[model samples]
Target: MSIKDIDDIVVHDISKFRPQEDISLDSTKKKIVEKIKLQLKLNNTSIRKLAEKTGMKHPQILRVTSGENYNIETLIRILDALNLEILIKEKDKNSNDQLMNTAAL
Candidate 1:
């Protein structure tokens, strides 16, 4: 099923589920880096090769790919090297399945 369909079908107050304590930016960055690495199959590339291709140090590449702390600049560089772009969108306030179906078409 499309993400929109799933989003429409599933009803939950995500705001309530958010952690009470502030989440560390490092943790958030690490999760995003790991997700991108997995999606792009970065692990298949050797550290030296990735470093050479991305113009980043081998250690930094390893750290970012391995879900360790990485700077935003590093993340952007890695994404650029992989020819990927990040998109940020606000969720629709209306939970309309019909809208989702139309969007899918």
Candidate 2:
């Protein structure tokens, strides 16, 4: 059964989830980061544990969670460790929000 309309989906507490360092990201990057944050929350995993799994230090994961750094390789590794994968698909340009919000991480 369909759970909800894509446009109706909401991710709660992304901004308040963790202490972030001062970081600047364009709106698209910020949306991606927020979706990643949501995925982490959904997986019930912590950055420290993810670090241990990925052989990366806490600070590196912290950059990802905090939006200070988002090297694609780093994100891919992190997502892989979480048993997640990215699937990019074409969407209507006017429907960017739903496309990103419903991205399969």
Give the candidate number with the greatest TM-score: 2
lDDT values, one for every candidate: 0.67, 0.72
Candidate 2 accuracy as lDDT: 0.72
Give all TM-scores, in the order shown.
0.51, 0.57
How many clashes in candidate 1?
0
Top lDDT prediction, candidate number: 2
Task: Tell me the tens digit of each residue's lDDT in model 1 across 1-105.
Answer: 998887788545553444423233444566677676675675576667778998889898878887776777998888777777777786454634443443344
lDDT of 1 at 18: 43
Lowest summed lDDT window (length 10), candidate 1: 15-24
Q: Which stretches of candidate 1 lie over 4 Å from their true place?
A: 1-31, 39-44, 91-105
TM-score of 1: 0.51
